[model samples]
Target: MRFDPQPASYRPDPAILPLAPWLGDPVEAATFPRHDLRFRNDRWARAVGLAELSDAAWVDHFGRFAPLSDNLPQPLALRYHGHQFRVYNPEIGDGRGFLFAQLRDGDDRLLDLGTKGSGRTPWSRTADGRLTLKGAVREILATEMLEALGVYTSKTFSVVETGEELVRGDEPSPTRSAVMTRLSHGHIRIGTFQRLLVLEERDHTQRLVDYCLEHFPGPTPPEDAPDRDNPAVRLLHQVVERLADLAASWMVAGFVHGVLNTDNMNISGESFDYGPWRFLPKWEPGFTAAYFDQQGLYAFARQPEAVQWNLGQLAIALRPLCDAKPLVAALDRFGPLYTAALAKRWCWRLGVAPRGEDADARLVSACERAMREDGSQPDAFFHRHRGGRNANDELAEALQGYAAVEDEAEYWSDDRPETMVIEEVERIWAAIDRHDDWTALTGKIAAIRRMGAAHGEPPVPVGHIRRDRT
Candidate 1:
């Protein structure tokens, strides 16, 4: 238990987001590398007691002056427009990104952690708001691999490479600038309800829709939401039921943020930005993660319709603050709340038990007849059907002339270790799969130091990811 980056007291939410006079000031544009940190994993190993803090004291107390917590939300560098693939940029807001503050954690909640390439600013248009230690090691390996595939994402904390350098004529040599820190819950976008439904600004868009239904509408508040239901069209069916359970937890953990826009939706419907993100390691619902999306428009099966077209740009940014038959009933709550939160997050990542009617129309006709003919790689069809693995001759040569696994020839199955483990999840997935089989990659760091001598856990690497706190 050796880490703590000194935090008994460290305030910053000092506020200042009112920049929209056509946004111009924010341009310091670079800083990071008071010493670089390239440690790579164990999800920022913030080991036990958050290991005595340094890695440059987790960048000056978690997120260097995180834009000095912009005095708690009144900070407004906001104003936006999007439709990247459908066309219609009309310029955007938080361009190279910025909104570096808004605290309240030790459980009381209110997060927002921001800071992507802490450089340029005034909505960085001519480029270089700097961020590229290969995009901060691909957003610290895409937010700790989507927080170990559990999802509700956005939480890197600090990555800071920027030993300083930049050229990006689109990567490879001549690129280095970096800075990161995520944690989020409300960077408030969907284009801040599409810039208050395109400037009709009804009382500052109903005071930002009553500051997002007095802090996220969940454990109460939806008693059939306002008028036949219009608490801003049932908070857009509760942010499309948390962005269709965050695009069915990024289609059961193959993620691909690639840029969903409506200023990268968040107010709690997590999975913020990891730029051209990726992780399908084989899957391919036209898998994308931006390389200029070549018209796939944020693919991986068009990420729940690019998050229901950024929740129809937050029902056209909460349609001038509501009323036109509850703004088309809050844009019909993004297709049955993103198809029943992507069929209960794909029946809890393929353990598959949920099926209230045609078993979700036979798993969306076995995922659109295997993503429309011969579709077999989505991680080798879920590591051979849900990670059990056997490979049936590499799934009959990667679904050769597909009969779509010949109508699942009596549900061709396997990876069903009853849905991704539980009872001590195979003693931590057989110790990270025997530390990924054989040569004992430090045998689960010597069986967590002989189970940290009866569950105390402090053997240190900063007491290992506290393996989910014991």
Candidate 2:
């Protein structure tokens, strides 16, 4: 599909006010002559007021890596530290990518245009900073599927295939190269806070808290709470709630993020930076996505624990600004909050109206038991029984009190539900590799969207409701 930018509703607002203190030195993007724009997310473009740029302009900005006129004059390679597999890695940062620009969405919320496979930077660390086209394709698939499943995620805004052959240890040698951009709420991460703490920059830590509170405020803290007015405590509470909901969403969608490292965890609670992600074929907690994860530290069932541990690191980072006890209090809420979010998400995915906390919990348990017993594909299982249909004796008992919220769609009438299993993904990629056929990928995306529409929107995170109690 080709697009020409018309009179764009484009509104550029470089609102990363904290960039001055948080960003590292500017870097130049590698200029590739072939700016073959492969993908443009028009849905998100319209939402961001950028639905109208000419094709040439789009390529110039996203493909050729030209600086946006009113956006950041130069790409800022953001500096931060993160723990890789529970090991502290102070050397970690934006090695291959940088923040391209920032703008406000139609909702006036700040959004970031961050790059992947753009070029090398100081953090590149002796490695060429180019992304294989297959890697970019995988990210597109990951983000698209996650969004369809109602996970708050980054949107792959643009992808341009650069004419270069990259050799990689994984995948075939001399794979094609590409540059892509992801539009996300904010790039601030749990690791971002860790960097501040490591530098002994208590004041910067407080500034970062203020930045998050102002830009990405969550439900207000309880009015009677000791740290209700404390921005640090409030931010911690908000991160916990968002991350918990994120973890639950992944579980309900049967997604394994593969990497739950601190650097990959966005503070805005949006999931991005997809790598080695997978959707489970059956209900198995020990399923690991990455080949390198021999220890299964980030297995499907352990995702909640991994995320909570990351939250703990974030809490520890907040110690410079607030009493550790208040942060602990906020951290303590993660377990119950995650449980509530999981139940709500599970009900939504199953197309059932939540009867109540206890009943919903029972329904989730019953669904799990049914899936395990039948050894069913997660997506198919949810698609088949959506709205409480085709339930066996066990599931019927738990589903008795609840009602299905969605009507059956035509897609469900098919013999099998559309799924993104590993083999199917490889089949799609093989077509691209051999014949440059994008039909399968595009068709699969459309099917996934239909499945999402069949289920309706997911329920809002339970922790989002504010309990003021003044």
Candidate 3:
């Protein structure tokens, strides 16, 4: 690993440390028994200029937790408080993971290198701070599929299998262990602000607002915003727009995040921390991803509601820095914004140019009704009707005058669309577990990317400013 030549062209930026000590606690990484490289995301690695790192160097920094130059000197377990399943938990923070490093991509956008299953932190409570190999594999699959479906999500950068047998109640006994690194736009969550509010750190909260505004630049505040120029109000409005789009994307993609806690809601609006997530196998509104979510708080159809509730929590957290009226006004935009996003995304998925709002919504309703009547999965339904083909009755009438986005694509001719349902995920995991084979997993990722390419570019998310340097 030649550090002088900088083969990776790394641009390390310790962007989070300025809010540190109070923001998080420096912690040591756990000593793993082995550092066997299992997975490497060369695509994203190259995007961030880390593709040149030797496998040994990759393991040294990510698996062994060596600090990158000009990055964080040590892993910092970020402090946060979140409402877990609607119950406030002040003891929670970075239990099994920490922000490892921050850097810039080719576009000069700040990116975070965060870890999962790295080690125990102050927030570990009584649970072991380790991730099962199965868990890591699932996250890789989740991020890849979600990204392909155009959700702003984290990238699973690396997965190093540690030779440690772990016991997990959720899975089989003596499961394999591994540490996974995620590449994301930012690590600041709504819960980050919640922690500051609980501690009455108004000044620090204001600073955080400013930092987010500068780092994750978004659209200007609404003209009717009570305090259009106020940083706090602007941040709230931006978050509302992003999360609304996020919720719509998930709904249209037929994906369930499973966990929609306040901590899981990132300020930058990128989705991360995939635990027990699932893509819809059928158009079941009550379909759930996590077995523990028996109450269906974050169910398939309830995700939008859950997101709105979480945004309300963020508004409460920001109350110390801004007037409640402005925050409430920002929050009220969610319903209309989400409806528009749903229509836009629904049309995009169907590979047709969107019609007027009413027509698009009618088309979406007809499509959903058709799915329910036929009991078809989203993958089958979307593929069967791409470019407005194979439609009749309400769907056909609603799709009138909608032009196809493209004349033809090779993927459209395929017999079946790629899907990431639980059965397929388990099949890939089973190959790795029983036969130590990775071909199935890699093949699925490739196919997912191809499907995404066939769909063409997704709708640009609202409130996200393009920051790439030309």
For residues 196-246, could you state the per-residue lDDT of candidate 1 as single tens digits? 555565666666655666555453224555454445665665666667667
Best by lDDT: 3
Ranking by lDDT: 3, 2, 1
CA lDDT, candidate 1, residue 347? 45
Q: How displaced is residue 275 in candidate 1, in Å?
A: 14
Sequence-dependent TM-score of model 1: 0.32
lDDT by residue (tens digit), candidate 3, 78-166: 99999999999899999999999999876667888999999899999997899999999999999888777777788899999999999
Where is model 1 more than 4 Å wrong at Cα? 1-25, 32-138, 143-160, 163-188, 194-242, 249-251, 254-270, 273-328, 335-337, 340-357, 361-381, 384-470
Q: Poorest 10 consecutive residues of model 2 by lDDT?
A: 461-470
Candidates 1 and 3: which is better by TM-score?
3
The C-alpha local distance difference test score for the whole of candidate 2 amounts to 0.83
Question: Cα deviation in Å at residue 96, candidate 1?
Answer: 11
lDDT of 1 at 1: 22
Which sections of candidate 2 miss by over 4 Å? 1-8, 462-470
* After superposition, candidate 3 runs with Cα above 4 Å error: 1-8, 465-470
Which 10-residue window in model 3 sums to the lowest lDDT? 1-10
Indicate whether candidate 2 or candidate 3 has the larger TM-score: 3
Write down the lDDT of every candidate, Cα atoms only.
Answer: 0.52, 0.83, 0.88
Q: lDDT (0-100) at residue 222 of candidate 3?
A: 69
